[model samples]
Target chain A: MSGRPLRTFAVLGFATTHTALAAEQLLRDLGVPVTPIPAPASIGNGLCGIALRLEPGDVERADTLLERAELRVAARGDIEDV
Target chain B: MPASSSPRPVAYLDHGATSWPKPEQVVHAVTRALTDLGGNPGRGAYAMALAASRAIFESRRTCAELLGVPDSSDLIFQPSCTAGCNLMLKGTLKPGDRVVVGSMEHNAVARPLEHLARTGIEVVVVQGDRTGLVDPDDVEREVRAAPTRAVVCQHASNLTGTIQLIGDLADIAHEHGALMLVDGAQGAGHVDVDIGVLGVDAYATSGHKGMLGPQGVGLLYLSPDLDVRTQVEGGTGGGGSESPDMPIERPDRYEAGTANTPGIVGLGAGAAFLIAEGARQHRRETELVYQLIEGISQIEGFRVLGPPAGAPRVPIVSAVHERLEADRIAFALDRTYGIAARAGLHCAPWAHRTIGTVDCGAVRLGVGWGNTSEHIGLALRALREIVTS
Candidate 1:
């Protein structure tokens, strides 16, 4: 954990800040427990540079929740630890 | 007991400007913002700032849902409908670009486009018919004739309350490779707005109008594909604060500096209330509008303007007098009968000219959800007495 990247954490990007915030809210409401944070520059495109962070192993579950809610995710991938 | 008799209740019929007596939730939400949420939104790392940010986002989400926007971030806050218009018109139109706008457009859209026109943008004014309705075919003909960059029109005529065929107009604009911009000031909060179905490039409305939000707040919905150049630039407080350029992100790219957090929160609550109440408010307002139209039509010297009876429209009605001045009748209705109504050109001189009321601007009575049959009756009685006496 010294200088490596955020491994195991899934950064879910969205087309806009509000949609990402909505995703975070819906995920938490569904017990997925996510936070809205700034996706790193190296990460894929996201609206307003905002992203939803999910627990290391909760990526798939979070995707299911978002899909069930009809929320679109721009990009979802594990943090590339440097 | 005096049977709870009090002074006569003023019949407020100026809602076409800004609705009054907002839903209770709006009042509570604003109060909560002033009390519970206190901090610079997106400016600090403190819990209070985070809470403030949450309120702002929540408000945006509510507006997005109400407008049926596909992505919430594409919509941002503006000080008023006028400001939103400036952003859309100025941000999109360039020198020598031709833009087409409806004859019934209010100053909010007309003024900005006019300024652009002076600065080398050509603004083509499409005339409306007698009913103040802009024909989509006319717009199509204009677009097909000119090298137009965008077609702008009001969803509903504030002067005559005639709702235009926006989806039809938008389709026409799209067919000619023109972006469609809709000034939704008289629409939105009054009727159901589905931006996706309407297929507009940009739609703007004042929150204080049909939405029942407070003043100093407006909403703009833009499709994700259109890149509207930002008009205002400053600290977004999101990221890239050090960079001189505004962020490429969605709302932060548009929202500069601080915002009216409390007012916007109130707007969100108001929208949420309307959404929950469903279409009951709309149905009530429609019925009252028809009643007002019929009752006013029966008045001997009065001529109710707009689409005739049985034609679909908003709750707004404008009537010009044959023997009396419009302002004089409006003043009598207000001073004598305690009915609040708007008179004059209603910031739409062109619309008056289209409806043949430019010589003597008409009096407008805009009913809203808060009005009832008793209020309408009082207004009708006042009109009858004013014309006869």
Candidate 2:
């Protein structure tokens, strides 16, 4: 198997784009690497088109930080590369 | 009306109504938001959209810092403090519920409560002392007498500049199972106010007043513990489209329709300026307020309102002339002295009643972030001449 990085990543969706941006700022402040991506259509409950994508390994860490910040996490999914 | 004596620069002491000559940073931010950051925030996933969203997010963060709000999402941008008051008062209280308020409330609070009263909500007006100070014990007595849904009071009186004991009132309200709401229109940027310390359930303030921002924008800070219902409903940009109801999440739940990007940007710049230079500005303004009070009090027929010289108050001073009417003084101040001031009931008829000036009203000079000793001196000299002539 080639040593290419996996395409699958953990995505966190929110009820509004503000929350998604808020989450992005919070995780970045906490030293967690995250990217704001268009929420895949697969995440059905996502109201905001934007979502935060992080390494699958960082899902639990990101969830803990976002929850602590009181940002509502609307949905979570393991999505392929955009 | 002939233009009179020394044509000194206009003092512009009407900051109580709204601050004039906003800081340079605020002007720049507003221009940038309108020209460069023109995208509708949260409308789409384009670069411009994200840039606009980021700018607004930064603005929210700055305002949250100034207000001591832990979660930036809890603060909502309002068109005016009046709108904020309506949302908090109407959203929380229902028919048959009772609310207590101080008599010094601006019409922003009084009018909404009046509207709510027409719908069966009971509004109790607690009279303050002669100095416009509200006693916490009086609030406690009212809440103890009956189950009150909320206790509303101003952080600082717009007419008299008397600062209220908000933390004590908040404690009393919580103990009595009532929400504590503050109209900080004159308090937030004029004096130090930390929502975390004040413990108010909700604080509504205008951005243009003490905040030193432009008009058409205000702030409403909601506590995490309170569950206020939505007041306005519309598109909140790319969220909860499937659901007809407003999204349950905050920052968007209460904020409906397109965001006021330019106004929010200006307000943020104003808040940031406060964070940098507010303490020094407050000290200078307070000194000027005392000077105005002392100088005006020395005039033969004028009686300065609000707290005594040594007492703590915001940068506002009002005085009623024994011989002249309020509007006449204000008119002379503007035309002759080139000093801007406010007269009449000050949009606070109840405040005028409390001070026994409802009939004649009082001339008010509101110190702002940029007032200096010379401005106060000019005003005092102008008042002396007006009273004597």
Candidate 3:
């Protein structure tokens, strides 16, 4: 068994930077390890300024939380690096 | 009115125009935002930009709590209440769509509806009572008569200080398949306003009036269910530069262009003040309003407008003297008594017409967070002297 989690990550993009920050706060409060980073140019297609980077394993929980908070996800994709 | 070496003390009572002498916390927040958080929020990912974004988010959250909006992102910042009203009206109503309104609206709501009427939208105005209070039954009748797209009404009258039955109106609007939009310019901080409890679809209010913030910033809350079309379009700082359309998001869909960061920061402080001291402030202002109304009614030629003393109304008391012009009385109050009051139509000619004061207008004494019993007493004495002399 490996002690560390996988290096693969998923990105969550929003229509505005404010919503991304809001999601970061909400997920962080819920104990979901999320990092805010500039949305990858390829993933956002120039739609959002920032995106949330979290382990691919926690993607479902984060999506549920955002949905519960009424925040719409504009773009989502997988990324290899920070 | 040349410059004088020694300035006379002022008793500012024109809060309906916009509150004066903002709280110390509000002033400091504006200065702090200008100095420390000087970044274009939502534009960059750096530390300064992130700090600015945090400040704006905190403000939106505080405003959401105060206004009873469940989602902070649903509240959009606008330049003024008028701008919010324009966005709500023009964005929601289309050609041939009808809206029901009351006669007690400020020019903020009326003028926009007027312009919309020119574009083929039908504006149906229901008459209010002499005190500028609209009967919900009348609103129901109008809404029932036609296929109304929305019911637009002011939560409180600036000219008369009369509070309308918003809950009842909202019910009527809902039953008739119409949306309820409120112009809450005079009611947000002075009265208890919970958009969810009131069941309104939209509310537009000025930050400076009841919220005790600086001018040039306002709030508009849209229900999650309603989707209003975007009115203004520009860089929202959320990217999407290649597309001509605004992003399909909660706030970015509506809030385009750069924001008033300093103004929003100041409003956050103002909202915080209201949350902490609102109850005590409301009680004090209510007492003072009754006193002003009763004392002014005793004057020989003065008759107060709006609800009677001891009735629930905003802290506004407008009076018309039998012999003097309204503007002249306001001038005398300003120069001789150092009491600031508003006169004439108060930017609500339709309201004056409804109250039968269109011919002479009324002198309005609007109380706010800064008024005191001593100030009210001085205003009473000054009015007695002005009327008798």
Highest TM-score model number: 3
Relative to the unseen true structure, what is the C-alpha lDDT of residue B60 in candidate 3, on a scale of 0 to 100? 90
State the lDDT of candidate 1 residue by residue for A51-71, as single tens digits.
666777888888888898877
Model 3: per-residue Cα lDDT over B1-389, one tens digit each: 31353444467898888888799999999999999889888877777777888899999999989989998888999999989999988889999999999999999999999999999999999999998899999999999998999999999999999999999999999999999999999999899889899999999999999899899999999998997988999888785757988877768888887789999989999999999998898999899998899899889999899887888999899999989999999989888888889999999999999999999999999999888999899899989888888
lDDT score, candidate 3 = 0.89
A-chain TM-score per prediction? 0.77, 0.86, 0.85
TM-score of 1: 0.87
- Can you give the DockQ of every candidate in the order shown? 0.17, 0.46, 0.50
| Least well predicted 10-residue stretch by lDDT in candidate 2 chain B | B1-10
**C-alpha lDDT of residue B139 in model 2:** 86
Off by over 4 Å in 2: A1-10, A30-32, A54-61, A64-70, A78-82, B1-9
Ten contiguous residues minimizing lDDT sum, candidate 3 chain A: A1-10
Measured against the true structure, the TM-scores of the candidates, in listed sequence, are 0.87, 0.93, 0.94
lDDT of 1: 0.85
Descending-TM-score candidate ranking: 3, 2, 1
